[model samples]
Target: MDFKVREVVPHGRNYALLRMMPVKGEMPEVEPGQFVQVEIPNSKSTYLRRPISINWADRREMWLLVRRAGAGTNALCDLPEGSRLSIILPLGRGFDLSVRGNVLLVGGGVGTAPLLMLGKRLVTLGVDVKFLLGARTTSDLLQLELFKQTGETRVTTEDGSMGHRGLVTDHPLLTDGEIDHIACCGPLPMMKAVAAIARSRGISCEVSLENMMACGIGACLCCVEDTVDAGNVCVCKEGPVFNIKRLKW
Candidate 1:
């Protein structure tokens, strides 16, 4: 679907919130843990559409929380309202909402984007949701109030600028008691560490990979990850999200 940029709101120092509405057709179904490939217009240097995680989406609008980490994202952040961009959305399978119990959603830095919709989805289904967001400092944390609307929220910062003064894996909640499951998206190291903790406690875990992607679809095998079942699978299709049990690490 082609989406028109409705708003571009900056968040803190490094991130921006982009809100877009479908230009012609109805908005495609968007799921948490799924992403959209955004066409960056007027850029001769960058050819492939950038794959951005779907932050949150409603029937009429789609939200993407973009982190200005490179040239591609910088161009996206500079896009003005009323600009149009082509988007391929709701790709790949989202988190399994079937398992019901206290569930924790963990995100690091801008990785928190997809979890917003995931949290909202879980809340809509009446599941208990807890969010553990980590950043370098408090200023790096994005959209806390929004997450709070759906579930309990917590934070961790390396600089101790807010909440717990340590890594998210060090948060007492993970070891405090029984949590039925965990869904995490973030830096590779953080996701791996969180997965390790979940595995040790025998809690099922799902992780969203942020592997570099050129084509958002499976055709371009650039974003492949070595999995236990499948030797090398495209993270763009087989998953931006996958069960930890299916992963080698």
Candidate 2:
């Protein structure tokens, strides 16, 4: 599907939120947890199709919260309004909205983008969902108001500058056994921590990973992850999200 570059809203010093204007208002035909492979025009070799988390999608417009951390994102930031970009969207499987009990959603950095969308979907589906956004500093915590609009939102900054004064794992939710189901996306250590917490409580958990990919499809076989049953599975094809129990990590 074709997605038009509608508007770019700068988030922080390094991040910008992109709004995609859908042709015929047919946006959001995809799941909340899905993603789009976007290619900005005139991007040099350093810039190319980048995988952006599907922040939120609807019939008219879709938003992507992207951090200008690298050449690709930097090039994307230069795109002007009304500029058109090519996109292969709503691709890949999303989180399984299976049982709807109390759900714990944990996110770190840009990984939090998709989790926010997931939280919205769960809320719309009438599933109890709570979010815990974690970052090294307050400056790194983006989209506080957006996350607040979804459901219960909490933050944990490594520094005492904001929200909680330690790692998000320090949040009481992880230790209280209050989360019926756990879903996490973040740095490897953070996700691993959440996984361990879930394991200790015997609660099933799922994780969305940010792996390198040469091809968005499985042909390149670049984004492979070691799984319990399937020795290696493409993160883009098999999943960007995987059950904790089945993952080798």
Candidate 3:
């Protein structure tokens, strides 16, 4: 389906928060960690559509927090408000929303996009939601005030320009022993470190993988991830979201 760009809000030089609406009907229901395969317009060098996480969604609007990683994303960020974009949405699996009790959401860089909707959904379900957001510097953090509105929010920046002076794993909350479940998305190393902490504490945890995907569906064999039970599976189809137990990590 084609969506019309409603607005583009730039966050410094590397990221843009795009507000879009369906060109025809109301927006479709999108799960927290699901993504959209967006076709970049007027890009000669780009072929495959970029898979972007569903940052947030409502009845009439959808948000995509995009990082300028390459030509495709840079073209997307450069789009005007009225530009039309073709998108295949609600693709891939999302975080399990059945969770309850004390839940902590950890994210880094652009990987933090999906957690906002997850936190909001969990909040509506009466789940106690908390966020541990990490970035390289204070300026790298996105949507702090919005996250605070959804839950108790914390931060960790490598430069110590934000909440805590180290990685998210170094934050004191991880050792507090009060969290029941953890949902994380970030760089592979960060997710692995967070998963290790969760494993040591015996806390249920899930991680969203940022695998390279040429096709958003499983056909391309571009985003395969080796799992404990499934062996190698396509991350774009089987999951962008998976429980720690299922992963070979």
Candidate 4:
């Protein structure tokens, strides 16, 4: 679907919240943890579209929390309202919403983008949802109140500028042994540590991978991830989200 930029709100210095609406048809069904490949307009250097997580989506609009990591992403962040951008959306499998349990959604840095929608969906399903967000400083903890509206929200900052003064794993909630399931998205190391903690507690866990992607479909084979069952599959197709057990990590 091609979506027109509706708004771009900046967060601190490096991040921007993008709001977009479909150019023609009604919005397609988008699942939390699924992503979109966005076409960067007027960029000579960026040939491939960037895969951005679907932060929040509805029938009328789509939200993307973009980090200005490169020239391609910077161009996207600078887009004006009404600029049309092509997007291949709601791609890849999302977190399982069926299980009834005390669930924790963990995110590090901009990885927190996907969890808001996941939390909102879980809330609607009458499932218990809690969020654990981590950042380097309090300034990096964007949209804390929004997550709190869905469930109990906690924060961890490396500099002791937020709720807790360490990693999300260092938070008391992770050691409580009450969490039945966990859905996490973040840097590889953070996700790995969270998955390990979940494994130690025998809790079911899923992690969304921030893999390098090109086609946003199975064809490119650019985002291949090795798994225990499947030899190597494209993250754009087989995942972006996977069970902790399925991963070789």
Instruction: Note the clash tally of each candidate.
Output: 0, 0, 0, 0
Scored by lDDT, the top model is 3
Local accuracy by lDDT, each model: 0.89, 0.83, 0.93, 0.91
Candidate 2 lDDT tens digits, 98-191: 8489999999887898887788889989999988989989988888887899889889999878898888889887778487898898898999
- Compose the digit string of candidate 4's lDDT tens values, residues 5-99: 98999988889999999999889998888998898998998999899999999999999999989999999888887899988877898888886
Could you give candidate 1's per-residue lDDT for residues 1-249 as a string of tens digits? 788999999997678999989998678777778888888888867888888899988889899999998878888998989999888787887788786899999999999999999998998898999999999998899998998877889899999989999999999987665699999999999999999999999999999997888887899799999999989999999898999999999
lDDT of 3 by residue, 109-190 (tens): 8889999999999999999999999999988899999999999999999999989998999998976749999999999999
Candidate closer to the true structure by TM-score (higher is better), 1 or 2: 1
Give the C-alpha lDDT of model 1: 0.89
**Compared to the true structure, candidate 3 yields what TM-score?**
0.98
Q: Can you give the lDDT of residue 151 in candidate 1?
A: 85
Winner on TM-score between 2 and 3 is 3
Lowest summed-lDDT stretch of 10 residues in model 2? 40-49
Off by over 4 Å in 3: none
Alpha-carbon RMSD to native, per candidate:
1.0, 1.5, 0.8, 0.9
- Could you estimate the TM-score for every candidate? 0.97, 0.95, 0.98, 0.98
